[model samples]
Every structure is written in C-alpha cells, then in structure tokens.
Target: MNFDYKLFEMINQFAGQNQILDQTVMLFSKFGPILFGLVFVWLWFSKSGKKVDNRKIVLYAITITVFALGVNKVIELMYFRPRPFVTYAVNLLSDKTSTDPSFPSNHSAGAFAMAWALFWHRKRIGSVLLIMAFFMALSRIYIGVHYPFDVTAGAIIALIVTAVLISQRRLLDPLYQNILQAFRKSKGQKYYRNM
Candidate 1:
C-alpha cells in the first residue's frame, strides 16, 4: 500500500515539468486505445499471408479487451477508489476529471488485453503494442488521474483474462470461423473468399 503511493509519486513527479514531454505522454494516454483498434483494422486489411488467421486473431484480441473492460466496470461498482488528484496534493496535468472509480484502470486493462492477446501470436507487433501500452499506463499515473496500483491491478486483470480466453480457444474457434465466413460473403469482401 505504501509502495503504491511511492511508485505513483515517482511517476507523477514528472507532471508539470515540461510542456513537450507532458504533451507527448498526454497524447499517448488519450489515443493509445484508439491506436490499438486501428492496428487491428490495419492487420485485417494487410496483404499478410495468413489473412484468415490474422482476422481471427484480431477478433480474439478485441473480445478479450471488451471482456476485460466489462470486468473493470463491475469491479469499479463493488470497490470504488478515488482519483489521486481528488485525494492528494499532486501535479495534475489534464483538465479532465472523472466520476468513475480509480481502482483497476479501464484504459490499462483494455490496452494490455490487446497487447497480451497480440503478443501470443505476433511477437513483433505484440511487443511494440506491449511497450506502448506500458507507457500509456504510466502516462495515466503521470497525469495524476490514477494510482500505480490502479494500472497494475488493471494489467493483472488483463493477464488473467487473456489466459482464460486463450485457454478457451477451442470454444472461440468455430465462432471465429463462422463469423469470418459470413463476413467473407458480405458485399465488397469477395476477395476475402480466397483469404
């Protein structure tokens, strides 16, 4: 508990230091989730060899992220933790404020879900996403909207969710296949038939 505050202090200490650095981190924290979705879209349309498998992987990752986010919402309802800025005297960067509970960050949970999901299949892409996800999670702390434990808990939740979903791949396989087949037959997706 004490260590959580110390770790958060170490990270949030950087806030209000420099405009350029703060701006960069703020941008990452804001758009990191959107970037993850865009990456999946890009992967779906890429000329990569394993088109079918890539699409399936994208679906799996998306499902995991969505599932983790749902879990976060439920957890927030049961256990509410105030934002750091709301509780302490800290350097708050962004002007935004949230009524939502701070424990188990939704941003970190969803981002890490995508990162860990992709990491299992595409190491290079997954590694890059994972790194970006970490920085994004750290940025949340720097902005003083979340404690370090919030992001850490979020990441742990993502790990557990990813593990559970991956283990149930068999249940997901036929669903992915059927969805892909239906999508392939849709208008403007004729080329997907060969994929």
Candidate 2:
C-alpha cells in the first residue's frame, strides 16, 4: 500500500476533469505566494500592528521564505525524486512544468513559511493565511505536478524553519535594528543621533 502515491492519485484524479476547477486550483498553485507577498507588503506599512513590530514580522516572514527555498534546493541537489508527471501518467496542467527534483515543493515551502511566520505574530490573520497555505499545498497535488508526500515534506520544512527563526527573535532583533539605524543615518533622519 503506497499511501503517498495513492493519496496523490486520489487528489490528481480531478485534474483536467473540469476546466473551472482546474483553473481555480491552478491559481492557488501558482499565485498564492504572490498574493501572500502582497499581504505582507500591506501589513508592513499598515497601522494595524500598533502593538507589534510590523516591519520585523514582515521581514522575518520574507527571510523564512527565502531560507526555505534555499533548503529545498539543497535537498533537491542531495536527493532526487522525480515529479509525478515524470514517473506516472498524469493530467498535468502545464506543459512548462519544472523538471527539477520534486521531493519537497518550493511553492509549498515558500507559502507555508510566509504564512506560519505571519501567524505567530497575529493569530487571527495567521489562521486565515494558514488555511490558504494548506490549500496551496493541496493545489500542488491536485495539479498533478507533485506527489502528496512532496508537499508534505515542503510544509514540514517550512514549519521547522519558521519555528527556529521565530524562537531566535532576540538574536535577529539587534541586527535588524542596526540596519534600521544605519538607514536612518544615511537618510539623515533628525532623530538618528539620539539613538
């Protein structure tokens, strides 16, 4: 009983079965990260995070996503797993699909990393983002490009990275604050010298 393959097939069986559903899932698969990125940008400057350091939260989220992508690439180089479309007959959504190893999905890793980082700072907003993150992971399986386990592994990588970064906030805070201080000095902010 190959549960990974079986679950992947179950989700992928719906691929190409309907045009509208396929397009909807494809949107999540392809654009979810960009949408989340937009959210981060909006949150960065918004006044809603009055009680929290909004800029730091968004910066950490961006850093986590970048690091998760690097981890995914390194793992791919060390151990390869062919995409579902390569190993089996699949209703693949794109002819321009990636030929890279697919043990852990880059999209899933990036999306989940960003989402989880946000969630730790704002529980309400994070809950919604996490649900969207889950859907994005499922979209990868539904689109027939990745196996179930691939997205699962990506998500696990995201969780670990987000946790480590969030837990080590004390170490990262001073570095970011110093960067901000330098920026203020370069920009000639009047209050720069007071700090």
Candidate 3:
C-alpha cells in the first residue's frame, strides 16, 4: 500500500555505487529468468557430450517450473502488490519491464526454485545457483522493481516447494525418468543412456 522510503533509500544507495555492478543488476533484471530457464532446458535435454543424469535433471526442472509457476500465480492473485518503482519516489536505474504485481517477486521465486532443485542433485552447482539466486533477488530490489519482503517471500516459497518436491522424489522419480527417456529418444541421442 505504502512505500518504505528508508529501506528504499538504503537499497538505492547500495545499488548506485558501482557501474559494473549496476549493469550486472540491470542485465539480470532483464534476462535472468529467460537465461535460467534456458539453462534448465539445456541441462535436461542436451545430448552433446557429457553423461548427465537425466532423471535428476528432469526432476529438478519439473520441480522448479511447477513450483515457480504455482507460487507466482497464487501470490500475484492474492496480494496484487505494486512494484516499488510504481509506488515509491526512487530512481529506477533499470528498464521498466514487466507489468506483474511485485509482492513475492516471480524472478526470485524462479531463481530460488531452480537453485534448490539443482541443490538436490549437485551440491557445488547448487551452491553457485543459490548465490546467483541471491543476487537475482537483490537485483530486483536494487533496480526498484521489488521490496526486500517480496524477495524474501519468494525465497521462502521456493524453499517450501523444493522441500515438497524432494520429499516426493521417490514417487515422482519413475515418471520423470520415463519422460527423460522419451526426450532422449526423440532427440535420437544417447548421451544419458549410460546414466
């Protein structure tokens, strides 16, 4: 309803200092969702060289995609919060892209969903992803698109979804594996046959 000017000014000041960091924030703010999605798809489907475990990849992708979409839609419908830039007197440094409601940032939700999903498979990769997700969340605030609470809610939602998915991995693994096999077969690729 109302903007928190003190918090906004703090984030704005933090974001205003470094040109490279600002550009990084802007770039991720604009394309991080698409880039992360592409990375998920590629990790799951690519048959070029490495023998990636298809089962884990598919499960991660499914978990992240399903949870991100469900949480985003529910929060958007329930909260309908305005973007920070729309509600506050802040200098929006990034492009005004996206018309979606701001509470529980979709970007942060997606990033954390993907990060936690990957964490289930590979600890190192998941650590990197988690770090990336953190930055992505900060970028949403830094660029004046979302508030700290929004990003925090998104991260929490992602963690909940990931926990549920991981707990049900036993039940879901078979179907996910089958889907991955079908995908590999469709591509006429044997990259993951050994795995």
Candidate 4:
C-alpha cells in the first residue's frame, strides 16, 4: 500500500523473470562484504609510503563501519518493519528469510560506511567502492530482501555517521590509537604501527 513497498515490489519483480540477474544479485548480496574487506586489506597492505597514512585510513574505515552497524541495530529495534517477503508472495531470490526487520538495511549501512571511509583516504578507490556499494544496495532489493527506503535510509545514515566520524578525527584518532597500542601489546596480528 505504501510507496516504499510499491517500489520494492516493482524492483523485485524485475529479477523474478531473469534467473541470471537474480543469481548475480544474490551472489553480490552474499559476498559483497568479503569483497570490500579484501579491498580494505589490499589498501592497507599495498601502501608504498605515499602521503596518505594507509594504516590509519584502514583503521578508521573499520571503526566507522562497526559504529554504523551498531547504530543500525539500534534503529532496527526502534522501528521494526517486516521484510517484503513476509507480507507478500515475492519471488524471493535470496536465501535470507523474513526474520529480520526491513527498515534501515544493515548491508547498505555497512557498505556505504566503508565506501565513505575509503573515499576520505583516496578518491579513486573510494569512488569505485561507492559504486560497488550502490550495486550492493540495489542487489538487496533485487533479491527481495530490503525495501527502497530501507536501503536509502541505511545509505543516508552511513553517509552522515561516516562523514561526522571522519570529520572529527581529532576526537576519534586518540581512541583508535589507544586501541591500536593495546592490540599491539597483545602481540596479535602485527601491522603498521605508524598510526
């Protein structure tokens, strides 16, 4: 009945007929996180002592993503909307059932947060990551998992939170540095200590 659900159904209908597109969206929806994670690792380890502090950038990106996802969980609890598949007989291409709330998609939030964080460090990589994030968000809808508003709200939330966090680096850097030092002391996975 709502415009959001109407749009969700419209978008989801496109995939029901195209098996290949559905499969592609499903695969992207499933593996997008890993793909972004690998890219983050690549960005961190492939630094050639350039002007940018790759390690710090990577650390901040991770921090922003975690924080955004936490915020998403709180939002989910405050405003619970069932998944589209639950209310309608949608051609659910994804394996995810209608168990989680629909509004404020976590996938979109995490993806955009990382993309924005990456953008803060390097424009080219960040732009590409943002495109990937957009596709990831679209894939969720195509696979009949999230509504348009859910993805939109998630992206908006991530963008705002990530921008604020990055802008307040003076406040956040100390916390990140303290954590890094503590982790380093544990002799865990060793990484660049220049942060």
**lDDT for each residue of candidate 2 in 64-146, tens digit (9 for 90 to 100):** 99889999999999999988888899889965578889889988898899889989888999989999999999998888888
List runs of model 1 lying over 4 Å from the truth. Answer: 188-194
Q: In candidate 4, what are the lDDT values of residues 48-140, reduced to their tens digit? A: 663236667788888889889999999888888888888888878886595889888999999999999989878998999999999999999
Model 2, runs deviating above 4 Å = 184-195
After superposing all C-alphas onto the true structure, candidate 3 shows an RMSD in angstroms of 3.2
Least well predicted 10-residue stretch by lDDT in candidate 2: 186-195
User: Alpha carbon lDDT of residue 80, candidate 1?
Assistant: 88
Candidate 2 has an lDDT of 0.84
What is the C-alpha local distance difference test score of candidate 3? 0.76
Over 4 Å off in model 3, which ranges?
A: 1-5, 16-18, 45-55, 97-99, 188-194
TM-score-best of 1 and 2? 1
Order the candidate numbers by TM-score, best to worst.
Answer: 1, 2, 4, 3
Candidate with best TM-score: 1
TM agreement with the true structure for every prediction: 0.95, 0.91, 0.83, 0.88
Q: Quantify all predictions' global Cα lDDT against the true fold.
A: 0.89, 0.84, 0.76, 0.85
Candidate 4: count the clashes: 0
Total backbone collisions for each predicted model: 0, 0, 0, 0
Query: Lowest summed-lDDT stretch of 10 residues in model 3?
Result: 48-57
TM-score of 1: 0.95
Question: How much does candidate 4 score in TM-score?
Answer: 0.88
Q: Which runs in model 4 stand beyond 4 Å of their true positions?
A: 49-52, 177-195
How do the residues 105-135 of candidate 3 rate in per-residue lDDT, one tens digit apiece? 7788888888888777778877888898898
